[model samples]
Target: MEELTLTTPALLFSAISLIMLAYTNRFLAYAAVIRNLSEKYRERPQDSLIRQIDNLKLRLNLTRWMQIFGISSLLLCVLTMFLIYINQHVVAVWIFGTALILLILSLAFLIREIQISAQALQHHLSDMEESLKK
Candidate 1:
């Protein structure tokens, strides 16, 4: 294996930063949608609305986990750089590897969330089709 250096972990800094930004944006969008859904549910209280809210709740939890893992990865990367700075090359390599695993987990959660979102949209489209038939 190649010798681990400070610059190695530094490379992930910008990539992780951009990913965190995208996660934050996704979180904000979910919050807005939940607020709107809450108001609508309060006014009408339909079964369909309840289902949608439940789906959103699951998606929101997934989003939270995604952020947690992503942030943890970023933190680990920073720690890896610190470890290298202090001449702990072996530990730094291990930490950097763990950080990469965390990032992979975060992306996996993101894929699941996107799949759920697509399913939710499909449900809406099906409902619209049914209404049109009626």
Candidate 2:
């Protein structure tokens, strides 16, 4: 295996920063939706609204996990760079590998969240189609 250098882990800095920004944006969007749904539910509670809120709750949890893992990955990447800087090349390589794994897990959660979001949209579309047919 090639020697682990500070530059190697440093490479993830930009990519991780971009991913974290995107995740934060997603989280903010979800918060807005939840707030809007809460107001509607308060005005007049309905089964559909309750269902939507439930779905949002699950999605929110998933988003939280995604952020957690992504941030952890970024943190690990930084730690890896520090290790390399201090001449701990072997440990740095291990830390970098773990960081990569965490990133992959974060992306998996994102994929699951997107799937749930698409399914929710599909449900709304189906309801609209049924109403139109009536």
By TM-score, who's the top model here?
1
Per residue, candidate 2 scores C-alpha lDDT tens digits across 1-134 of: 68888888788889889988988998999999999999999999999999899999999999999999999999999999889888898888999999999999999999999999999999999989999999
Backbone Cα, N, C clashes tallied per candidate: 0, 0
36-107 per-residue lDDT for model 1 (tens digits): 999998998999999999999999999899999999999999999999999999999999999999999999
Give the root-mean-square deviation of each candidate in angstroms.
0.6, 0.8
Once fitted onto the true fold, the runs of candidate 1 whose alpha carbons sit more than 4 angstroms away are none
Task: Report, for every candidate in turn, its global Cα lDDT versus the true structure.
Answer: 0.94, 0.93
What root-mean-square deviation over C-alphas does model 2 reach?
0.8
Q: What TM-score does structure 2 among the candidates reach? A: 0.97
Error at 54, model 2, angstroms: 0.8
